[model samples]
Target: ILGLLDDSPECRAFKQQLADLSLIYGKRGERGTLVTKTVNPAPLLETLQYYFRQPADFLEKQIHLWETERNERLQSVRKTLQDYPQDVVEKFERHLKMTENANQLRELNNEWLDVPIMNYFRRLVQEFARRLTESKVLEKTIDVYHLTADELQEATAMLPEVMEVRQRVHERQVEEEKFANVTPPAFMGAYPVDAVYTLDPLTLSYLNTEAPNPVDVPGGLGAVPASPGKVIGRAKVLRCTTAIN
Candidate 1:
């Protein structure tokens, strides 16, 4: 942590957490290192980023200065060659061409360096590749550059005409969210909602089944209300949630 700058609110927050946790849990097995303090690295990071950029700016300025000097040198050599003997003029042209060739190569390299987009894209691809590899869905990862833009859009977008059933449901949810300002219906009858598919160290997928007893498990939210009084035709009872979260 950089001691030069004042600690920000975020640093103070985590420092408090470390103190609280140490007091609450003490040392693990009575031999573990006690959580004593938190270090704020934001100030150090800011200093490093600015300090490195200073040298880079200086080098860029030097390149411009060198180009100006190289042009002046080439003009002076060509002008003197025009008045010299034929042999001298030939040697001067050869020297000029050699320097020009080296300068052109440097110019091309500079062009490549100026293209910061490639650097940004490379970083984006690396992070996406890492996430895909960690997910282990297809047991491997592919370059994001190879994936079409449309595929990425489909994964995030919830257009109404999406073909996938999961996407269609997702689109409906998106539409429902727009009306979130409209509070849920009054606290009457069973306003059964979605099922919570929580990971309890095993496959507890049967958290919302009904048929057999309909009201066996209390934690499973039991059965839907009987909708007493008037005989409201035969509408859906929604005995329990259908799908997973």
Candidate 2:
């Protein structure tokens, strides 16, 4: 059994700490998913236990390998940058420092702030959903998302009939599905003429602005790898959140 199956206090606390590990703390729409989406801890805990069984130095070795590769790339880039003027090198160094600092802050925020807060909120919602289901106020736990915060509060105070709440949820869900196939306009009531082109480099990158050009390859696809390694496993594509199952 995975360590997560243990009923010990330590194991329970460990699971609680990482309960939101898979939460998508990104923007709205398709990218927005909460810890509630993956309430079960078995999958994540099982994967971690499998890795924990590897050699004692397994993780350390991987980190060392990555550091070596990164240093090599840095030296190569520095050599190439030597051909540029001093001011250019200084500008590059400044940008590099800024990027490193930004990344550090992002990691700090995710680990200490975002993850804990989101998971705490998820637990609260789950507890409320459980109570709502027990009181026959909700058809299911996940249906809690159908009600706005104020509506949910009212539901708690004034125990409404299940049919009435369910009907309200159904209507809202139907309205949402109406826009499933619709593509939103690129700009909505824009004011400035230069607004489209005035975005900073970082903002444009975050928006995933188009590539400068496209390249054709012979019967193959390419992508920038998020990490260094290869693994053979069955791949599944999730087109929508509900498709996960």
Candidate 3:
């Protein structure tokens, strides 16, 4: 009865408690009836009756609403895609190819994934919109189509800028090349001090003297004071690596 009303954790816990109580009753030879005449089956009966009596038109109205919303979303996506320039289109095609390759790699590795490819497609659409907005293409196109100035403004704001669109497409290409020419850093020489500490030596020396005592350098083998107050504890190494698992 509680489960029918709500499937929340508290309700579920209460139901379990009822089951335990029933078990206790059963052990005490009171299994048949724990609480005489306490159960009123009217709510259950009413729920079942209500479900059976639901109007047929209700489902039709819901279906129609869903279909209308879906069509609108599809139309919006199509309109955004149609506005893409030739260069943008070529970049988008390359991104699509990279995405397909990534999906294939996942499949080959037998990895269960939830990569929301539709989201990437939507982002592309947004980039196209932004480009249209920045170029005032949407505004001009709307004007050419005799759409109201207000409508054009609204439409244009919903789209992406041209540079943003190009960057999004280029990002996919960059990611694809990331693993292609991967090489481990050469560890042959005495840790090439200059490369090991990319910061200017003057900058490092200045930071070191800023504190009263010789502070352990940040981004090195030791920790610098991150906060004002001090406490004693065994130092734990915190690794900051960018390697993808």
Candidate 4:
């Protein structure tokens, strides 16, 4: 897409994340689309940066809340330990140390985002904000997904419809966010079938044998394999969606 005539570098989300520029594109069903709307790139860029500020802003709030909660809990632990006998107090102190270790491990998700994933979600917010701001079709950056190719083609033409669809998406997002223990579905399909095929960039190959062979009932769909382990699922998350409390 980098070399494509219509798909400018900024229009591709992955590329946009690197360039910090909005890409001009929308989606239509199962197809990729190039954006037709045009606007002053300068103001659009500013709007995007401001939009991107939201995640970091929330992070600041989260850090303050986390610190407040952590201190309160640590103090509670100390208070509780003081009333206990020596043997119990030692055990509680040991457990407190273990709890601190666990909290540090949790930082791998919270404060220490790296190239692998948590950081990528932040990049997604930036990229989506850039696209929506440049296009000027939606108030919220995430509402960009509510657009169809035809709707985006005319820029502001289908905005009311776009907002209606966005509300629906937002509602679903809210419901999904409320799910706790986060409901793993009854089963994900075997790989190379269902969503797994479309998810992978490389062309997939499956059973090609024409001869009829007796088939047996497949065993239970279970845990990820021990070696070269794989789990297949796709999920979309928004900044508000990730908050535990």
Best by lDDT: 2
> Candidate 1 on 141-243: residue-level lDDT in tens?
4433444456534432443333233344455556767887688767888865644323321112223333232444656556433222233233345545873
Whole-model lDDT, candidate 4? Answer: 0.48
Which rank order by TM-score, best down to worst? 2, 4, 1, 3
Task: Give the CA lDDT, 0 to 100, for residue 67 in model 3.
Answer: 90
Q: Write the per-residue lDDT of candidate 3 for residues 1-245, one digit (tens) a residue.
A: 45463578887676666666644332221133322222334465579677668897877888999999978985775576566555544555565566557544333222111223333444555554555645855432222233333544555565543222334334555775786788867766586543222343334553554522334667867544333333444444545554422
What lDDT tens digits, residue by residue, belong to model 4 across residues 1-245?
A: 23342375445655445344333221111112222222234554567767687875786898899999999998987896675556556656676676567543443432322323333444555565565556554566766555555544444454433323455557666775788548677778765432221211111111222322223347933322222224244423434755633
lDDT score at residue 158, model 4, on the 0-100 scale = 47
Question: Model 3: what TM-score?
Answer: 0.19
lDDT of 3 at 210: 53
RMSD of each: 34.8, 14.1, 30.2, 23.2
What are the per-residue Cα lDDT tens digits for candidate 2 across 1-245? 44634589887666556654535442112123443233455665678778989999999999999999989998998997887666656766887787777764354455445665676777788887898899898888988888888878778777554434888888888888898878999877876743223343454565568533223356855433222234444455666899986
True-structure lDDT of candidate 3? 0.48
By lDDT, the better pick of 2 and 3 is 2
Please give each candidate's TM-score.
Answer: 0.21, 0.41, 0.19, 0.24
Top candidate (TM-score): 2
Clashes of each: 0, 0, 8, 2
